[model samples]
Target chain A: MLGVLGGMGPLASAEFMRRLTLLTPAERDQDHIPAVLWSDPRVPDRTAARLGGGEDPLPALLRGIRGLEAAGCGAIAIPCNTVHGWFEAMQAATPLPILHIVDAAAAELARLGVPRGRIGVMGTAGTLAMRLYQQRLEGRGYECLVPTETEMARLVTPGIAEVKANRVAEAHAPLAESARALAARGARAVVLGCTEIPLGIAAGPPLPFPVCDTIDALARAAIGWARGA
Target chain B: MLGVLGGMGPLASAEFMRRLTLLTPAERDQDHIPAVLWSDPRVPDRTAARLGGGEDPLPALLRGIRGLEAAGCGAIAIPCNTVHGWFEAMQAATPLPILHIVDAAAAELARLGVPRGRIGVMGTAGTLAMRLYQQRLEGRGYECLVPTETEMARLVTPGIAEVKANRVAEAHAPLAESARALAARGARAVVLGCTEIPLGIAAGPPLPFPVCDTIDALARAAIGWARGA
Candidate 1:
């Protein structure tokens, strides 16, 4: 059974579960993967703590992992990209494999037939600060494009914030604007690196450029692991 | 924090979480109600046991209840209507308040401005057998309309089974046929008592008669409790 360590923002985790069920090749409830979602929204803001003086979210993350472990979960998946900044520490604390969102997104990019050229990465400021997607995807031989500080402040950040506030339709303009900007600058594809960004993007029109949704990517990864792929 | 005792068929529980999120009048992630979904799909079939020659789900249910209590959930909501047959026994085993699905459905019927005429109740055989909704709705001065054994065996049962198997589109026809029959028989409104029914209903055309989705009703009740309504 998979353990979903979520509520890093509840909507994303729930979306992952919804996507998991959709993506699975199952004929019945019994054929579907059995999982537990330890969705404690009380876990302190991951991006805040990583960016500066917010309280540490490590203890809470570990508690979720241990709780799922106690519940007999064979593996774990945390749907938030910003929180993956703590991935190493969290993984070190548990024996179970925590599916890596960056790896999942990279694999999804490949599956989408995105050439190994340029990829845009959009996420919470903390995810960019930690260079989460860039570092790993770059290692996979793809050059990364990111939002400028002005673009981040003016469009991406506020767009993600609106999604967190449930103003999904309002979030699209700014997020799409940023993604379009990245595409104009030669980005082959844009990674909706933050979980919130995908919700924001889905709120409005489809992007002209090929794009990868990390939530779906991570969900596919979790499904793969569950199905022993 | 709200504890969702789900996975009485994983899809329904996940839908409950989705409905809970959508119904909440929140402007941001923090403003949404905090919840943990203990979605263990391993619990034995409720309908099978009630009809005889099947394993009892009590011990598994009790484990889930205690697990939620230990996780510091302030209240509990079980989304599956059929499992509510064990409501008293489960509630007796926990200090945390378990929200009643029938009461929530009754209140929703009132909120929707349905008159005190015949209200249809559709659910798993166990829920009907245990009189989970029938007796309670009857007490509220509402005439209860249930599917005949033929309707249950032919339409309702197979439709629900398809939903459990994630064949939502296929489930729609039989389920809709059942609802139309109920409305033709003078049902003022139908309470989609089974969690899976609403999903099936949503897949196809909308019902002419007013309908109350127990999942949404139950979610509203959870929100009410969380917000002190």
Candidate 2:
């Protein structure tokens, strides 16, 4: 069974589960991969941790990891982007191999061999501010482009929040503008780091560039791992 | 932290969480109830057990209960309807208190001074077929009314399947009709015995009679228990 470490925003947890189900190629219910989601909203805010305003989310993340492990999950995945900043700490907390969203997206980009291509990274303010994805991708030899400070405040953060609040329509105009700008920068694919961004994309129309939905990528990877095992 | 045994269906689990947030009188995030939801859709079919054609769900249910107990859940709540038919076995499997949905609803009725009033139950065909809620409510000194066999086949059975498929609107018309019939027969309140029943109710407006949304009742009871402790 695929175990999800979630509840960064309850909506994202739901989104991750939906993506997992849709990706599974099951003729019968039992044929589908079994999944256990530990959505602990009490986890200290990932953004707060990045901003140095709260305790590290490592403890809560580990709690989720251990919960899934105890539930007999062979492997685990954390859906939240900002939370993945504590990926190493969370990894150290549990023995279960966690499929990292950032790593999955990076692996996809690497596999594509998109040399010198502008890769867009969209996520929470903390995720972008920390340059977690940018740092990771740069190490993998990819040019990562993120939303500007003003755009981050105007577009990505609220877009994520709107989806969480089930107000996807409200996020469209700004998210489209963000996507358009990223595409204009010679971007090959926009990485939706925050899990909620996919909900916005689904609720809105198609994007300008190929949208590499990180959450979807993680879910697909999880499905692959579960099936392979 | 409160651990939720969920994903009997994703929507049902999300609805239960939403009701939990609404019922809490917290003005700040910290004041709100802290919860951990472990939503596993992999458990063997609850209905299939009663119908005698599936693997036992006891192992899977106990797996979740043990997971929650390890995760330090103060209490546990399962939002599935048919699964409760194995309530005795589940209780035996876990040392933790698995909050009983039927008992919660019956107690609410008793507290409302309608101890002996007629309580209408609307659930899947499997739930009604097992007579789980009927027996439990009667044992608690309440009269329970379930749908006719024909109604169960045409309305409730298909209704449960639709909700699992996330096609809840299809179940609304039939459920509202059933609710109205029970109300006419002097049912003080209708107990949405199936977790999916709330999905049908949420799709439309409220039923004409008092409707005790089972998922909502479970969350409320969870919050009270948490606070009292």
Candidate 3:
């Protein structure tokens, strides 16, 4: 059973669990995988940790991992994309394999055979500030693009906050426009690096190329891993 | 895969899912049952439907069940206790067998050999107002007890609302007192009929006997059914 270490924002955790459910192929109650979720919202903020403005999230995260491990969880998956800044440390904290969201997204990109594609990334300012995905994608020979400061404040910030506020409809138009601009800049696909983006944006019409929703991609990857694909 | 027809209250839905995750015993990701959850807070109030005060919830409920069924959910479970009042109509609305929280609770009581015992039930004013559990338990030869109007308003109401608001810490004392009174009234076990109740009052010291957490019981049943045991 995979243990979900979540509450990086409760909605993201909920989405990850919903994705797991939707991806499972079953005709009845008897056909589904078990999951243990430790969704303690009390954990220190990931952005705060990344910005070095608050307490480290690693200790609380380690406590969660230990709780799941003691509860007999097999592999662990963290839905928060940015917590991966301390991914290596968090992984070392638990004996269970911590499934890297970045690696999973990168693997999906590789399998789609968009070799050396330019990918647009949208996430928390902290996530962008770290250039985590940019580094990871560039390491795999792909270019990663992000919105500029003004656009980040206008599009990404409101989009994520809207999701956090459960007001997705209000943020939809701006996100669509942002994705369109990214596609115009030669990005093959837009990676909704923020877990909250999928909750708001509808990318198909405004964006010329496909918007590879990282949440959907992560869900698909989880399904494949569960099915031993 | 199990489809959860929930979001009558977000916290209630979350607690039900937590119970399911905690109950399943699996060593690997593929070893557990998968779940699809449709938590449409948009579903009309069940109390309103019962009292003929508002639009029927069946339409919105059908939408939730259909979403999960279309996604290939094998069995459907509705987490909200009060919503089970519309179970017959909901079943008529879909081809799938949507499990009833009432039936699951009754069955657990029967299995525990406390079939005719005095059971204290705690739920929303709407659920208690419906007497869904009272009727079901009476049909199965059990005596059911609900809190008086004063107790309902002072204890059950705020306790349930605290859970819905995610103010679980604030709910503890009020629920503990209620548990004691119910046990004092010769109740053998307290039935946490409302999903929110389980989140706030799962294992309190004041209860005379086992607190038959219906959400946990339903989840255990779901897990058992999922494992084909």
TM-score versus the correct structure, for each prediction: 0.94, 0.78, 0.54
Q: Could you list the CA RMSD of all candidates, in the order they appear? A: 2.1, 4.6, 16.8
The candidate 1 chain A region of ten consecutive residues with least summed lDDT is A22-31
- The candidate scoring highest on TM-score is 1
TM-score of only chain B in every candidate structure = 0.97, 0.92, 0.91
The C-alpha interface RMSD of every prediction is 1.8, 3.9, 15.3
Candidates' lDDT values, in order? Answer: 0.87, 0.75, 0.71
Segments of candidate 2 deviating more than 4 angstroms: A22-29, A92-94, A103-119, A136-143, A158-190, A197-213, B7-11, B14-34, B40-42, B51-56, B92-95, B103-119, B136-143, B165-190, B200-211
Backbone clash pairs for candidate 2 read: none
CA-based DockQ, model 1 = 0.57
Between prediction 2 and prediction 3, the one with superior TM-score is 2
Q: Write the per-residue lDDT of candidate 3 for residues B122-153, one digit (tens) a residue.
A: 88788888888888778677788878888988
TM-score of chain B of 3: 0.91
- lDDT of model 1, residue A175: 95
* Candidate order, DockQ descending: 1, 2, 3
Report how far residue A207 has shifted in candidate 2, in Å: 6.5
DockQ of every candidate: 0.57, 0.23, 0.03
TM-score result, candidate 3: 0.54
Locate the minimum summed-lDDT window of 10 residues in model 2 chain B. B25-34
